[model samples]
Target: MWIFGYGSLIWKVDFPFEEKILGFVKGFDRRFYQYSTDHRGTPENPGRTVTIIPAKEDSRVYGIAYKIRDSDIEDVVSHLDFREKDGYERKSVMFYPISSDQKPFEITIYIANQDNINYAGYADLKDIAKQVVKSVGPSGPNIDYVFNLADAMRTLFPSVKDNHLFELERNVSALLNESSIRKST
Candidate 1:
């Protein structure tokens, strides 16, 4: 069974997996809509997805593809279904490899509800900052999601650099600092 990781699962896979390969899916993009109850939750209720949409651009989303045992696929799918909620759908995607020698693979992708989507396009640093700061899911703040993505990207594909998330994080941190100062005043 093949599993795709575009967010926290990229860095934090508690389960055992066989192999991980770098892959990308075109047209669709990644966002921090899924929340984390494990990291920051009130105990009673946890982990949820925030309403966020991908940017309207011709870009590739980098993620890891894991080959798991067929027996374990059920467990993994169950866990993912719980995390993604009922609205999200799992669709198969063709993952293109970054290396010329490597072959592409097909994997499942979790897509959000497009009928009512929340577009998170950053017009400037401030817009990106606001999106990061305000975005929260069943899990936690969207910042954690970005940090996880950054960590995974560094570990898995050190040579490949994607700054869309990092730039947003920087903008959010700056905005957070400004907000704190304003609050103090």
Candidate 2:
């Protein structure tokens, strides 16, 4: 079995994998439209998280695909399911490995269902940044998640364009800077 990770999972894969490949999936856009009430925020103060929004055109969402060893499949799935219990559901997506030598394959990814109550839906970058700036949960601060993801993506796929992610990152940085200056004064 293979596991596809696009957001935090891209940077943080707690599970052991036999092999890991950098890849991109088409027909979806990674959007900060899901509300995280577990790993990122509380029920009373939900934080923004990423979920794939189906796109009409062929869009490439860069990520990593991890090949799960047969022996570790059950344990990995269990851990992933618990980590993604809030509004996420496991869905299959075809991943195109960056290395052409490797064939593209399908893997399961945890995505937030549109009908999920915790789905934050569409919001501009500034508004999303505003919410992320002040939210924290069991895993950690919400802003840290965004910052880590952005940095990870840039480091991994240096030439890829993830506008929504980069824009939100810029806004969040500005917000943090403003807050810091205010505190110092």
Candidate 3:
């Protein structure tokens, strides 16, 4: 079985995989529309996380696809189910590998759609940045999630443009810098 990861899973892989492929899934836009209560924030102040939203047919969300060993499928699924229990659900989608020799194939992805109870939906980038800057949970500060994801995407897919992600990263970084300067003054 193959699992597709576009967000934290791209950089934080706690599972074992036989093979990993750089690829993308079409017809979706990655957005910070999911509230992360358990991992990045508390119940009182949830931090936003990426959830794929339906977009134009040509839209592509670049990510990594991991091939799970047949023996590890059950264990990996159980672990992911608990890890993504906040709002995500597993769904099958076609993944297009970046390598020319690889063909597109069906793979599972965890997605938090609008219908999820923990979905934060849309918000201005500034508002999102402010929330992220102030939020922290068991996983660590919310800013780490945004910064790491933006950095990972840039490192893994240099030419791809993820405006929403990069914009949020910039907003959060600026906010943090301003806060640091204010404290120093």
> In model 3, which range of ten residues has the least summed lDDT?
110-119
The candidate scoring highest on TM-score is 3
Rank by TM-score, highest first: 3, 2, 1
**In model 2, where do residues sit more than 4 Å from their true spots?**
none
Q: In model 3, which runs have C-alpha deviations exceeding 4 angstroms?
A: none
Q: How far is 75's C-alpha from truth in model 3 (Å)? A: 0.4
The estimated TM-scores of all candidates read 0.71, 0.97, 0.98
Rank candidates by lDDT, best first.
3, 2, 1
Q: What is the C-alpha RMSD of each candidate to the true structure, in Å?
A: 4.6, 1.0, 0.6
lDDT by residue (tens digit), candidate 3, 1-185: 99999999999999999999999999999999999999999999888889999999999999999999999999999999999998799999999999999999999999896787899999999999999999998999999999999999999999999999999999999999999999999
Q: Candidate 3 clashing pairs?
A: none
